[model samples]
Target chain A: MTAKQNTQNSLPQTIFRRKLPKLLLSLFRSVFLLGVGFVMLYPVLFMTSESFKTVSDTFDPTVIWIPSSFQLYNFKMAFDLMNYGQALINTVTILIPSVILQVASCLFISYGFARFKVRGINFFFGLLIFSIIVPVQSYMIPLYVNLQSMHLLNTSWQFYLQALLGTGIRSGLYIFILRQFFKNLPKELEEAAYIDGCNPFFTFLYVTMPNVKPAILTITVFSVVWYYNDYVLSGMLLNDHFPLSVTLTGVSTALNNQLQNMAGQTLGADIKLLSDAILAAACLIVVLPLISLYLVVQRYFTEGVERTGIVG
Target chain B: MAASTEQKTKNKPKRLRSLEKQQRSWGWLFLSPWLVGITLFFVLPMFQSVLYSFSKILITDNGFELESVGFKNYLYFFTESTTFGPYLTETIWQIIPSVLMILAFSTVIALVLKSNFFGRSLARAVFFFPVIIASGVVITILKDQVMMSGSSVSDMSPSYLFQAPDLVNTFSQLGIPDQLLSSITTILNQIFDLTWKSGVQILLLLAAVNNIPGSFYEVADMEGATAWEKFWKITFPTISPTMLVVITYTIIDSFTDYGNLIMQMLQDYYRNNNYAYSATIGVIYFVCILLVIGLVNLICRKFIFYASE
Candidate 1:
């Protein structure tokens, strides 16, 4: 067919005419996408660049994209002001165990929804969806009052307990995702395990769980990031022990206090540059770990997203 | 042999019933965690919140006391309060445009990224990076920096199509309606914020697009279908279910967004020891969100394609 078309017209002209629109379209797409990519990355890059800038360079319009000179003092100042080490430890302490517990509990709940034939199961599932739709703030005041009465505030137990019960932030969505993944799995594997005298619990642990690793990973990533980024819940719950997110929010005041203690000066009108730099440094410190984690697990992140979407 | 087979068949139904009962027990057992969670975290709190919304909550050394007010808080919100009405309207306005913009922008971007173009994977990673660090703290910090730097946000971040002012001017010269012009500029001005929020939606859409069976496309190609035809015919219908999911997610996310004015107002009220008012506002906001979600689902239901089992 191509040879006949070539005979009907000069081959080179025909090919050029055929390819011209496609080439133009591809070029347009590439430029547009790249431009959008730059826009997406600009804030992070700006944050990074500003984090290292000296107070003078931050205000210098000429030094827009990059710092004229990289200064380590801002990081040092931010670290001391934000109590970066302790906050990081606090964040990890709260996030890691909660992520594990949430993932495990959600897996169990989703497995039940996916595999078992229970009466009124759809009603129960509707409750899960309700949990997702209702905003946390609506119930937060009551939850806070209850926790205060129980003296459960200012501890990791609040997060851990919720996670264990499969009610932590976005746990409903996680369960929904995992349920879809589990439903799509072939029933033959579980049947085979059952025929070999495996109980349901053992079958779930050894058979179903292993096959849904991608979904598990996806939920874990989301759980970790969401918990890490959470401020309102953590801020309300923990008073003495603040996570990186809560600490970052208070960095400005902390910086002001530190300046007052060090030089007997307030964060008055003239201190915008130093304050901005310090805040940017604190923001970077807070986000660095998650960024590195995402970079390391980029492949699994994308795969998990794809798998969840398909199953969902 | 016939007597034995009949006996076995009779036993099979009883055995199956027992097995079904066992499965039901196991299912409830597995769901025990969620049941407890729902009761304690969701149901109890929701009940308490509703009660609190209807009463005046006074905190004392011993504990808090709730005195029944019976719709006074709701009345104040509706008739007395000056800020709630505007804030609610502002939130509704914000929700509609942002959700629509995100859906449109993300679907197009996902389609573009779905194609096998050069550096496509890298482009995807770039688009998805926001989801990893889209915390309220980070966004607030970045937004503050952008404001402090004395550069317009549109200048710092690329506008969706063109600078709002330029687009508005051109459209005005072209005699576009005032209403249309203002709406266009409002959406364009929100392009930066919309882009950030669209990251997850884009990923979801990209995944959905990729999930379409290749055979469908091959068949379309064999039929000499144009790219546009293929998208409208094959791609759109196949991905509509995921599109519904994305729309719901986006709506919920936008309503509860940290930067939302209503949320900020509610937080302020709560901080100022106005628990009843805060709870009232929370419930109102929640009902609004539910209405929006219901409306969206109803609209999308006609188009969503659920594959028959």
Candidate 2:
């Protein structure tokens, strides 16, 4: 009986040790992931591909699979209508300053929270997070009233300056991320700086900031993406002064008009094709920079999230 | 010689203490920009909102005019306003279902992705990319193609697909009944409402899962506990802090999104100088949110096992 039981247990162990099941399981998981991934990525691909399709081919569901011909003229027309050059300049104008200010202010505040043992720091920090929790929409009316009172309404500077003051959506997430990183850093390095007669500010500048470079890069990329794509607030702040995102809306409005006038135009197919090209061109112009930034910093951003130990 | 040198050096710092004080003063001085920004911008303005919530303001050729109203705004919200009750109810109604779904879906996704598998990283990237791209502007730009103006997305397509009919038709032909189809559609619609919106919660859940110690799982195996038991005992407790974070994040995210039509109504009210009605509605919605958060916290406290320090 003992021999038989030993053999029975050993038989299953031998089968479990085989590599086939694990490999099959992994293959199954991969296929499932790929299917889901395609589903997720389809919309993006559809929008991009249709941009290259001709106007008459656009509504033809059969042609949706791929563009028959890559007509680049649609892009030219779209660019002209949207004033892409001017909008790109305006976008950069806001993007650069807003990014710099957001990173700088968040760095200081996060450093303060992480390094100092000041009284009531926790309370104040909690309040800051509370501000983040409240819907920004809730503050819109009040913000408008205050800005109107400041006589800063309807100016480009209104968006730029409000963002620069660490009050933008970028700062909240950036500050939280940076603080988590700062908290995790070994205190020995700053202590060594102190031993070498360096003060807290200098130590932070030379030692801490350099160490948190990944987090800083993450913040920079995040700010560019968030502030650049913002339309609702940007819409309210800059009346008729269109950024790239806003210009996309303006172009959409124009496309609808072209669509409406299709019946009268002799060159209806060409016009539709032109509209398709413009839409694709516009999407490409706005999305390409951010996507590239994402691809470059993708590894660092993921690594930084884990390193900061800020899963939440 | 060592003792004498140490003592002398310690005394040296005290001798130059006045200079040290001046140097230290620069810390606060360095902080002056933040101080000015917070006081004038954040602190002062926030207080002004609270004040404005109670009082009515009238614009003039001169600076603005203010009329003191005590409890009138609060009373209107609780009592007589037509939209205030329904608006508060609708906002809360949307928030609860949205948050619950976010928690359930994100938790499952995080749990599945936590396993070591092929293409896991890519899967995560795909999941996260929507959040990166789908801001208000991107959505607004896509609105013409994705949704029709003056249509409650549900009414336009099927209330379930954000008006994306192609996907719905595919699902329907899978031999699903109309009622079952409708329910599935509603769920899909809700999922669409919450997916990109819950990025913060997903990150939190991932953090919680990562924090669970491997030793606990090893011990559970030694005791002959099943995989399910290990999950129940070890994984669940470890991630409770993250659960709180996700809950709080989801509730606020769903509530404050500018896409909500009711919020737009509130905005219109304020723009039209209907301050009293807007404040009443705002305060009601604010209270409802607080109550929901409080309930979640109370319930979770029972199960959130904190490791003994």
Candidate 3:
């Protein structure tokens, strides 16, 4: 009987020991991830919920997470006050041309750096890396003055010039990414193309460019998002015609003024409340396109980031 | 016919040399845009900024006039300025802890996200959401709203989750010094902000973790390695390069962040028509960033493992 008891106890102990730690670890992971996910997502949820809160509901302490009444009017007010349509158009006009110019120029520059043994290439590449380290703010004052003298300020030509010259917003990072991608490509394709009587340019166009599509797509998306999100450059350069980002900055004051005119009573404290709601709504609108784009191309986005080896 | 073919073969080397020269010229042709950009935008502007920093810029009828101040602005900034000292120190203090927290948080979160779990993709999307929406305008608005609501409802709010004064008090009671307590609370209070800024870092770290060869883990497992042992031996070394990159990226990102006290000060100066002084401050800040980056690179390089190609 004692021997039987010992066998039974040992069997149960082995079974429990084999499965318990794995189960506990998975449970711990889930709980930890859930907690972090909540933290990461709470702000967005707050923004969305706050955007739907009416001016009165915004200040009510009990009204948390869910609005007492769905205030769809906040979106309309924000849209009109921020001039969403015009700002969106202005942003796109600047963004599309600049994105194209930046991507094309950076691709050419990176390909040259990657494939060629040009003299002083290392020196130039070192300077390129240094430029990446130097924040735009460091040179903004001088750039502003330079642009003003060139009559380039307050015009889309400023962006076009920078993009054409491979110095647009975050262009250094893009070039770095592309160069790394190109350097890693196998030499066999270019060799084959050359043997087939293809010139270097044609070989790059046919054999090399197609292979780096994911990187190209990556740069395109990143450039577009960065340009779209840029407020400092747009604010400094284009004073009269505002992009979506710049417009969003002053949307609060604009909404405040609009609310006062409509309500006609001194909305001194209430203005803050109303404007906060409108600001939330406007913030959502500005970021809507980017979020949707990320969702659609999530796979490519992750893959592109992986390929660039920026982390590595 | 044999002699003619030999002559053709003899010409091939010369032809190839010319082709190489042509390729070199084409390379420069392709790189011309960048070259021009560097000269016009980067190099010229940087020199002009330095000159502006050392001069008193005056707006003239025709154009701006620069009267050389012989380092007066720099002198004033270093010795006489009341605002610069506080702003600089505050920014430095903020950067150090925030960078550390972001690195640790991102690495841990990346590891967790890398594991095979249900709803992993959704969790990743949730984590990456901030990279999409945490724009300057959005963050400013969010902060204001949180502060406004936080003052009213001290508890039972998400903003309160970040406000851990009680935790700080408890730590203080446990013999933690006042200075350390305040710093701890400051970090705690800005936990949300730090987490928001960590979106890209997390993505980068996650990619780095995923790139680690599974064979390393399999071998470790076959040798009866503990999870902790495997992490240190296999995961850490493989991802050290990425850690350096993330750390550098984080430092730069944090320094140049738009929503910061120093940026606000610079903006104030710019708005107040202190162009020369603003340039001086900007240059100084840039130098500080360079020093910090150099320091980090120096320290991290010692531990960085480069797999031999």
Candidate 4:
């Protein structure tokens, strides 16, 4: 049909007008994506390269992508300095419970919102959105004081309390995401369960819970990332037994601590020179777990987000 | 529910009330945790903070004391505190264009990501890499490294590897108003930051686009719609609702961002233990955010095309 119409016109003109821009547009898109992707990945690649760079490599202008020599010692130094094992342990101790509790509580809360639109639920939903925002800095001091009074300031209990109660970091946003999933679910499934004389609680457990596994996995990944990446609260609250995030900001101090333990004093001179690579190594070590987790769950996470129909 | 509580009063209305009670009770069972959590973690703290904002907070060894000062703390930002006012204005100004640019960038990227292309997964993996490092502490650590490496952030921007701008520089070199120049230059310098921040928004818009019904596009094709026309007619309307979600999310995300200037201002006040002033700053920021979100929601909702069941 286009050939008949295009018989009157020159074929090259049709191709140029119709096909050229389309080809150019696609070409532009691919280049844009690849270019932006490279930009996005540059820091990671830069850090990776920097983590292995030696003293000589830093001064070498040509050594952008790779170093002249690989320095594995930076990893060892960063690991020791960061107190990696202890920090990881502390992080996990806080992380596991927060992820589990936040997911469970948010799952329930979101289900409730999705299932039943009672009077004033909108108000509470508004409040949930408010809580997602409303900068934590505003009320952080009072919260600190409260935790201090309860003798939970330095303990993991503070994290637990918030997570268990569905008020942890970004919990409201999780609730919002999960609610979209629950809301989109067919009502017939629940009605069928109810017709079978299944009670609401049991139906929630047996019927609704299993269907939202993708969302649970997504939020689980999110909660883990958030809690693992959390330093502000942990830094303010904990006086000792700092998590990976806390140690991250103090990699230099960790280096000092490592040296002090071994040599009875920090070798302050040349500390900056040595720290560049060590800092890069520490960043890699810190984010390695999260990156792997995201990689493993990314396919499912994307699918889950799509299925939730993230509409208005 | 099978056995109505009031045996004496056997009526449909009574039974309906009981069912309503059952539904309400079950719903609240699931919702009560949120209620309790909000009360303890949010309402109380938020109330106390607002009160603290309106008063003078004395950090006594035993506990803090609040001396009511009316609107003095609120007044401090405009009338006295220099950083808070300027920083807040800067942040508000930055957020408007930042949000629009992010939305447009994300929408395009999301379209590309969801569409079939060679090495798409690799591209996605690379694009989403920022989500791993985009958290406040990690990104700050990276930025600190960049700073410590004896290169200014703009000179050694992550984008500098691929993007060497001549036009941007030429445009900026051409005299513009200070406010517009500052904003544009700042944006030019922050291309990497802005692009990096698009990771989450891209994921969100990708989800929304993926959620679009295939039938809409098929129908558009049957009607001989061009790609651009189909996008504007089908994809645009279908995804308009999610645009609201993205808008709200981006606004909150940008405001609550770890490296935010206003947050830093609040931090400085906080480090000095000036709780009242910080509270005022937080409140003002909070109100500003609410206003922005509300206004955007109102505007976007009017255009939203909700697909009926």
Model 3 residue B46 lDDT score:
89
Candidate 1 lands at a TM-score of: 0.87
Model 2 segments more than 4 A misplaced: A1-24, A114-117, A148-164, A176-218, A239-241, A257-263, A267-281, A306-312, B1-35, B55-64, B68-77, B111-116, B147-184, B203-243, B270-280, B294-309
Ranking by TM-score: 1, 4, 3, 2
**Residue-by-residue lDDT tens digits, candidate 4, B123-242:** 777777776678747778777664345422234433354233664567657866668766666677777888988877776677668777677788888989988998888888877766
Which regions of candidate 1 deviate over 4 angstroms? A1-10, A115-117, A149-151, A180-211, A260-269, A303-312, B1-22, B145-178
Q: Give one digit per residue, the lDDT tens place, for model 3 in A1-312.
A: 999999989987977897887789889988988887787777677778878988667668888778897668879988988788999999989999999999999999899888887889989987887777776776787888788889998999999999999999979877876775576555777878988999888888888888776567757877877888888889888887798989988877777668778665656567666777777888888888777888998876766544532222
Best by DockQ: 1
Q: For candidate 1, what is the DockQ? A: 0.46
Report the lDDT of model 2 for residue B157. 30
Q: Model 4's lDDT to the true fold? A: 0.79
* Candidate 4 structure quality by residue, lDDT tens digits, A1-312: 898876867788889898999899789988887778877887788778878876666656666667787669889988987889999999999999888999999898888988875668889888988887798899998788777877888999989988988899889888887776676566777778988999888899989888776567667876888898988889998999999989999986666555555553533444454576778888888888888878887776766755643222
Clashes of each: 0, 3, 0, 0
| lDDT for each residue of candidate 2 in B133-157, tens digit (9 for 90 to 100) | 7664655444445333211122323
lDDT of model 2 at position A140: 61
The alpha-carbon RMSD values of the candidates against the true structure, listed in the order shown, are 4.7, 7.2, 5.6, 5.5
Among all windows of 10 consecutive residues in model 4 chain B, the one with the lowest summed lDDT is: B150-159
The window of 10 residues in a row where model 4 chain A has the poorest summed lDDT is A264-273
